[model samples]
Target: MTTAATSTTAAAAVPFRFFDVHVVRTRLLGRSMVRITFGGAGLTDFASGGRDQRFKLFLPHPGQDAPVVPTEAGEDWFPQWRALDPATRGIMRSYTVRAQRRTDGGAEVDVDFALHGADATGHTSSGPAARWAARAGAGDRAVLLGPVEPDNAGVDFRPPAGTDWVLLTGDETALPAVAGILEALPDGTDARVWIEVPHPEDIQQLDTGAQAEITWLVRDGADGPRTGLIPDAVRAARLPDGTGYAWIAGEAGTVRALRRHLVGDRGFDRKAITFTGYWRKGATEEQLVEEALSGTGPADD
Candidate 1:
């Protein structure tokens, strides 16, 4: 029972590590998104295979050279950080590492930011990190922390040998993670993915090594409100028979709902599913972390 579709083993690969870096380049990738690339000496030690790893981005004050946060020089950085006034600590946003490359004497990481508009995290207004991403350019420097260590970073995603079925669900925030999963699946993996996005145009085309039956659920325009669409889609999905894992992520409510539906309503093994609430509807990045630490979020919606 170690097929590419049913295995529960953690990735045998070494876990990607954290590093500090500086912004080397930044630009607009879409009407409402920006792509920033970072590089520096510390990046040289950054571990590989960080495709879906989350990172903490630290931005310096508008014209400051170095950030005010304690460096690795401190033994209890996070505790010290927790004691600082939120407003004075600057802002930190959670983002996925879209891609990475190492060459010469440095490494580079690319991150995509959804520009603030009618819909966005909203903390982008005066937050140092947000403002930096909004207008960052070459020659700018900032601290890049993470490759957030997942509690189970090395988990191998292959299915058990006898299984032939699967279910996948997530939103734009989780797309990169889902995409990473999809890319790792073997050919002919019998899986169906339900993806939710703000607009039809937000749908990204991906290339996967596995055979996947994918469905896109658009939010807002013409597709009705996103609401409970992710779980609804999964509820109505016709997955192949046999054991499989259910992967879900995104906004807190949506992820909770899908997790409940899969394991609670459908009777799947709770341990067989991977669910993550990447962010919240109205919570800022700071609030999201506080909530996570407090272990408070709506019951798996």
Candidate 2:
């Protein structure tokens, strides 16, 4: 059931399309970030226009030959992944589609992974993602699942239909999604963005037609949850006088606080704010979602 403000969809029924692609290029953007570009025959079938969507990456098991991917459906890959025993199956993590390029003029998905530590597998401290990324070559095979398009199109939280301004807030974890949102905005749109990062170097410039005021909040010396900077930044922010929307993402507690400050304290229209807790500090994705939706709710910072 969908109200005027909210629409309920069968999340599980959403198609989980898979793609088998070959790594075409690799670039290290920073100490913790790596960009891998992939393309192949399977790439032709991938849908374009989903810059901000996310998908699951299935890494080949250690020392195993590249797995074959079925073009029609993804069920073939699941059994092989499950055969590794519950403990040995490679870790599957969610990553944003940074950019997409296609020869047919469709779209190719560009994914940037935070490779700060070990790969996904526990055999090494680093997870499998890092290990695979480190050794990835131009011809390596990768199977991608659920490049599900996000549902937030035309859903900006700005007050009044087609407002002139917006405020964006998030952490490093939300950078890819933030970039996509900014890219999708109309030219000459006016907006302000405040991003919290570990250091000043993490501030990457964005290309958006919107008149954007981006503030980078550094967390180098912060001891508590890295998201504490959002509250202070928002407090100091000077939003446009006209109707504006508020968007906040990243850590769970931080997002919750910003939500309250806007709708609860500042009295922004309830429909004028969108906040998503992408991930928690010390919890897995499943655990974070469970805690967030559970009646007990996630703990406060």
Per lDDT, the best of the predicted structures is 2
Residue-level error in angstroms, candidate 1, position 182: 2.1
- TM, every model: 0.78, 0.75
| Location of the lowest summed lDDT over 10 successive residues in candidate 2 | 1-10
Clash number for model 1?
Answer: 18
**Candidate 2: lDDT of 81?**
52
Candidate 1, superposed: residue stretches over 4 Å from native: 1-18, 27-32, 61-66, 116-131, 147-163, 222-226, 294-301
Per-residue error (Å), model 2, residue 187: 1.0
What tens-digit string does per-residue lDDT give for candidate 1 at 1-301? 0000112345533434335566777765434456788887667665535435555566666556756566653457667766777656635556666777786867787776654332234344433444567766677766765533343343434344566676777776567667777776777777888887766667777778677888988775543223787777888877677888776667766777677777777888876776666666655655566665465644443
Candidate 2 whole-model C-alpha lDDT, 0 to 1:
0.63
**Model 1: residue 194 alpha-carbon error in angstroms:** 1.8
Give the Å error, residue 242, model 2.
2.6
Task: Assess candidate 2 and give its TM-score to the true structure.
Answer: 0.75
